[model samples]
Target: MKVKFFFRKKEPQFNSIEELFDAVSRKLSVIISVESITMPYGKISFKNIFKNIKYTRANSGKLNHITGHINYVTLGLKGKTILTIHDVGSTLNGNKIKFFLMKVFWYWIPALSVKKITVISEFSKKELVSIIPFAKDKIKVVYNPVKEELKYQPKEFNASCPKILLIGTKSNKNLENTIESLKEISCELHIIGKLAKEQLLLLEKLEINYFNQFFISYEEIIDAYQNCDLLCFASTYEGFGMPIIEAQAIGRPVITSNMGAMKEVAGESACLVDPNSISSIKEGVEKLIDDAEYRTNIIHLGLKNVERFKIDKITNDYLNIYKEVIEAK
Candidate 1:
């Protein structure tokens, strides 16, 4: 059967949603076609809404299944569409206006039209259900799959001055607190995303040794995980922490937030800390550095944790969902 996967237009920066479904498409057994649709420009745009509606209506019967972002949900394909809601982060951040608007467009409207809604983590599913209580019945939890190419590469840890990998530069990533926590700690910070001017200034003022790069390839991301002594992902919030699994698959011990999906994704394998507490972050890092056995144990746990997210298992999960949606039609 042919399935049409509708995706948002690719942005230059990191986007987990696109990365996820791309992997899903590669593994599915059915014929798949991907369509990139433009995102709405403003908070609520009638023009973009009409454009999306027209686009979906035009392609209604051309394929067996339609799937894309929740924001792109249209009323045209009542039972043939599936919507993926990554997170209700905007609602969680206390943006009341955005919350109300999202409740209307992102949840309630899509609930009427889409055949299924998938969330990456149980934490996200719970959060989404709290906002739209009626949606609890329809949502499914599908974990994101680690790329098949990422595998265990045993690399010796640098005891002298370890290299700590940091994946994102967004404010919610809690990079500022992480920097403060590592102020006196001796380690090289290898950051993946571009840093803001204020962040660079703070790093310089704190005298933290760091390297920052942007727009790197997937192979480079794997290299980052393989080379680093540990992965630090103390984000304040997340739908599902992909880096946690990626790092684990490469045999790197992880330090992540003790809240939300980070904690859920890490399971018992990662050193968890309060993202709001600089001292907690510091202490977690210190434990990983000062205690060799504890660190080694966590690394072994991480290797095992990664097995749950194997690409083949996650692919089959999506395949089942697609089959269910198509059979219902």
Candidate 2:
């Protein structure tokens, strides 16, 4: 039997989904012949979309899995197809016309082409079901497996001068709020994504020490995890917060938003704070800083939390689903 995992070409700075399923496909190769097809053109304009669809159809395998972020490409496939929807929050948040178009092309029409749908978190599954109630039975919640490269790297908590790692600069990441929360705190804020001019100015004006880096390799990401004292991922919205578990896997305490998928993915392992309130985020950060015992406890729980997202376990989950789809009449 043969299986093909379809992926969108990696953007210069982001390819988390592609990286994730690539690992799964590598493990799956031990059992069956598997191929990875990256679309020639990135998912953009009508011409590029049409080209990607045609290319995907020509290269389709017996069982096709469209990894997250390019679900609309499933429109051109046939046979047993599995599509992973990471989150609809980004797609559905916009002007009315854009929202309606994304709802149809990205979600509704694509739902008709695939045999099964997989979501990264239960929150994402519920969000998808709410948008297309008819597709509820077809949806499955498949938690993302933590990258194998991120091992448990123990680091001494540096309360004297802590380094707080914050990933993503997108609006949903609540960077502005986090920056505000860190204003008076004496710690270097290490931000992973591109920062706006206004953000940089704010950091300078507030006298908040920060280190900014963008378009780095995955190795750099692991390095950031290893070097930091704690991870602050207080995002306002997420389909699934991978960083929460990634930090947890690296044996670091996490301070994340209390609502949405962040809360769900973190379970009882993270210091939960209200994403909307700067005071709440500040409190969570300080709690992890001042109380070494509490920080150690969180780190312990985080390591245990990551076991649920083990790569072998998650890969096996996909293997079972693939078998069910391939053997279906």
List clash counts for every candidate, in order.
0, 0
TM-score, candidate number 2:
0.98
Evaluate residue 126 in candidate 1 and report its C-alpha lDDT on the 0 to 100 scale. Answer: 92
Residue-wise C-alpha lDDT for candidate 1, range 1-329, written one tens digit per residue:
55667655456675666777677777774545544444433233677667666665666553323344535445655337667778777444547786677678767887766677888899999988987777677789988898878888888888679999999999889999999999999999999999999999999999999998888877788888888999999999888889999998888989999999998999899999999999999999999998999999999999999989988898788778877877774
RMSD of 1: 2.5
Q: What value does the lDDT take at residue 30 in candidate 1?
A: 50
* TM-scores for every candidate against the unseen true structure: 0.91, 0.98
Predictions: Cα RMSD each = 2.5, 0.9
- Give per-residue lDDT, candidate 1, residue 199: 95
**Which pairs clash in model 1?**
none
Best by TM-score: 2
lDDT of 2 by residue, 1-329 (tens): 78888988788778788779878888888988889888899859999999999998898877999987788788778668999999988888879999999989999988877888999999999899999888888899999999899899898888988999999999899998999998878899899999998888888889898899999988899999999999999999999999999999999999999898999999899999999999999999999999999999999999999999998999999988888898888
lDDT of 1: 0.80
